[model samples]
Target: MKSEFQSHEPDEPFLSRVQRVLTDLSPAERRLGEFLLDFPGELGSYDAQELARLCDVSKATVSRFIRRIGFESYDKAKKAVRDERATGSRAFFAHAEPEANAAALALDMREEKDNLDRTFGKLNAGELDDLARAVLSSRKVWIAGQRISFSFAHYLFWQLTKIVPEVVVFPQGGETLGEHVARIQKGDLVIAIMLRRRVAGTKRLLDAILEAGAELALISDESMARHADARWHFHCHTHSDGPQFNHAAVLALCHQIVVRATLQSGREGRERLRAVDAVNEKLLQVEW
Candidate 1:
C-alpha cells in the first residue's frame, strides 16, 4: 500500500537492498525475498499484488517485504531494478543448477535445436555468398574474439586459413587491441566474433576498423545490436536451458562461412588445400 512506502537510499540497487536484510526476514518474508533474488528484474514488471500472488504471500506481507527491502515505493523499486537489468548485469544469468537428470538433458537438446533454428531461419544465401566472396577477395583476414568468444574465433581462423592463405588472431598472453588494430588495412577483412559479457572497448575497436576502410564482419549474440558500420552482422542465438549459453549455432555459423568461402574460392580453394596437405605430409607424414 502507499502507506508502506517510505524514503530509501536512492543509490542502492534493488537486488542488493533485498539481499542486505535477507537474514533478518521472517520465514514468509524470507521466502518472498529468496524468490525475488532469482529474478531481480521481476520487481519492475510485477506490482505488489501480483508479486504477493506469485510468492504466495498475503498483500500485507508484500507491503512488509517492500519496506523491509528499503524501497520508498513500488515505482521507485521498479525503476531501480529495471535500470540495473538494462545495463546487462551478469546477475540475470545466476541461477541454482537444475539436477543432472534425463529431463535436464532433454531440455538442453531442445534448446540447442531451437538455437539452430532461430539462427539459420532468416539467413540469406545470396548475402552469405556475397560475404564469402569478400573473404576470398580481402588482402588479409584478422579475427578478434574476447573471453569465451576467443574459442570460436580460433575455430574460424583455423578453417579460413585452409583457403584464405593468411588469418590472424589476437596475440597470446593478454596483449591489447591497439597493437592489432594498427595492422588493419583498407583491403583487409576483420571478423570480430563478440558475444555476451563483451569487453568495454569492443565497439571502439569496430569503429577504428571501419575508419580504416576495412570490411567488418561482426558475428555476435542478441546482446549486441546490429550496426551499419559492419559490412555484415550475423546474430547467433545463444539462449540455453541452463545458466551457460549454448554455442552450437555459433560453431555451425563458422562452418557455414568457411563452406561458403570455399565454394566462392573454387580452384584457389582446392589449390590452397593441396598445398597445406603437402606441407603436413612432409612434416608429420600422417594425418590425425
Candidate 2:
C-alpha cells in the first residue's frame, strides 16, 4: 500500500517536503526536522552518521526521516539540498549559534578573502578594457539595478560620471522604467548590476535594453554566469559566512571599471574632473 508520503508533488522543493512531514514526525524526527528548519542547507553539509550526531538521533532514525520526506536515498536528498542552496537563501545562514565571538569573525574574514580571490582569479583584464571602451565610446551609458543592487548601480553611475559625461542611472523609487527604456538609442550602453533575489521584472528590463539596440553589460553573482543575453557578464563571488552576502567584491569591480575608464579617457577625464571640482567649489563651498 502506498503510504501518505507517496502522494507528495513530484517537483516539491526540499524544504517544502520537510515542512509537510514536520507535524507528523516522531520526537526524534521532530528534533531533526526543527534542526533542518533552522538551516536546510545543512542537510547537504553532512552525512547520515554526522547528522545523527548533531541532531542527537540514531543513524536509522535519520534514514527513516529522509525516506518519510520522499527522498529515495540520503545521497539524493543531499544533492537536492545542495542544488537549492545556490538560490543564496538566508535560510542557509540561519543558526542558533552565537556569532559575536572571534571564531565567527575569523570565518567572515576568510569568506570575504575567498570571495575576492575567486572573483579576481577568473577576471580577464582584456575583458575589462573592452567594457571600459564601450563605456567611453557610447553616446549614453545607463546603470540599472534594483533591490540590494541599487546601491552598487548608483555608486557606479556617480563614479563613471567623473570620466564620461553622458552617464545615467535609473528607476528611483516610484517611477516606472518606461521613461528610461524609451530613451535608449543604438549607440547607448546599459550596465545592469543584479545580485541574488533579483526581481521578477529583471528579464523584461534586460530584454528592453537589448531590443532598443543598446549594448549590455551585466554585473551579477555567480548564479547568473550562464545568462547569455548580455554582451558582457561580470560574475562576482558574493558568498558569506553570515546571513547577508559580502558585496565587497562587486564594489571593487565597479571601482576598477571606473578607474580604468578614467585612466583611458586621458585629457577628457581630467577636464571633466576639473569641471566637477569647479562646481563643488562654487556651489558647495567645499575644498577637495
Candidate 3:
C-alpha cells in the first residue's frame, strides 16, 4: 500500500488533489483549500477571519479547513505555517550575535528552542536509517563544505574516519579542491554541507561530484530547497543566532549522522574503531 505521503508528489497538480480530497467539504472548506493553493506564500500573514474573507467563506469554514487538513484548529494550522517561516528566517540570520537587552536574549533563546523542537519533530526515522546505510555501504565517502560549512564537513570527516577509513574531507580551498573533486568516482558518496549565503566553491564541488557519478547527500537549511540537487537532502534548523555565522545545530546534526552510521555499520564498525585507536596511540607516542 502506498503511504499518503508517497502518493502525494511535490510537483503534482495542486488543484486536482485539492478537489479530490476536499470534494465532501462544505463550501467553506473548499474555499480555504483553494485560497491556500492559490496564494500559499501569503499564508504566513493570514488570520482566521482574514483567510476566510480572502476565500469568500466564513471563519467557521476556515476552521473546518484546518481539521480537513489534519490540524485540530485554525491556530494549529497558522502555527505550522508560522513555524516554517520562522525556521527559514532563522537560518538566514544565524551567526548574528544576540541583542544586548535581556528581553531580546530571552526571545532569542526561545526561538532557538522552538527551532530545535520543530527540526526534531520532522526527522524521519526511516529516511535517517537509509542514509546511514548508504554511507556505510559506499566504497568511499567525500565530505565537502566551504566557509561556515567547512567545520561541519571536517567534523563529519573526523567522526566517519573512526568507522570508515575511506572517508575524506575536501581541502578548504586551492587546487586541492579541483583535484579531490576530480577524484570522486562511482560508488562513492559525496556529502555536502551548505546553508544560507551558499559558497560558490561548494556549488562547484557539488557539480563536480555529480558529474563524476557519485551519489550525493546534502545538509542545508530548508530555504535552500532549490540549491540542493542531491539524491538525499537533510535540513537542519540553525536559527536564533546572529546573521554572521552559526553551526551549532549543523554540528549536532553531523554528530547524529556519524553516530547512527557507526551503529548501523555493526561489527566492521567496531573493528574500525579499534584500528583508529591504535593509530591514535601511535601518533601520541611519536609527538615531537
Q: What is the TM-score (0 to 1) of candidate 3?
A: 0.60
What's the best-to-worst order under TM-score?
A: 2, 1, 3
In model 3, pairs of residues that clash are: 95-242, 95-245, 96-242, 96-243, 97-242
Which digits, one per residue and each the tens of the lDDT, describe model 1 over residues 221-253?
876899887879999998763446789999999
Candidate 1: RMSD over Cα atoms?
Answer: 4.5
Screening candidate 1 with a backbone cut-off below 3 angstroms (N, C-alpha, C), the clashing residue pairs are none
Which residue pairs collide in model 2, if any? none
RMSD of each: 4.5, 3.3, 14.4
Candidate with better TM-score, 2 vs 3? 2
Collision count for each candidate, in order: 0, 0, 5
Q: Which has the better lDDT: candidate 2, or candidate 3?
A: 2
Local lDDT at 45 for model 1: 64
What TM-score would each prediction reach against the true structure?
Answer: 0.76, 0.83, 0.60
The whole-model C-alpha lDDT of candidate 1 against the native structure comes to 0.81
Worst 10 residues of 3 by lDDT: 91-100
Worst 10 residues of 2 by lDDT: 95-104
Best by lDDT: 2
lDDT at 218, model 1: 90
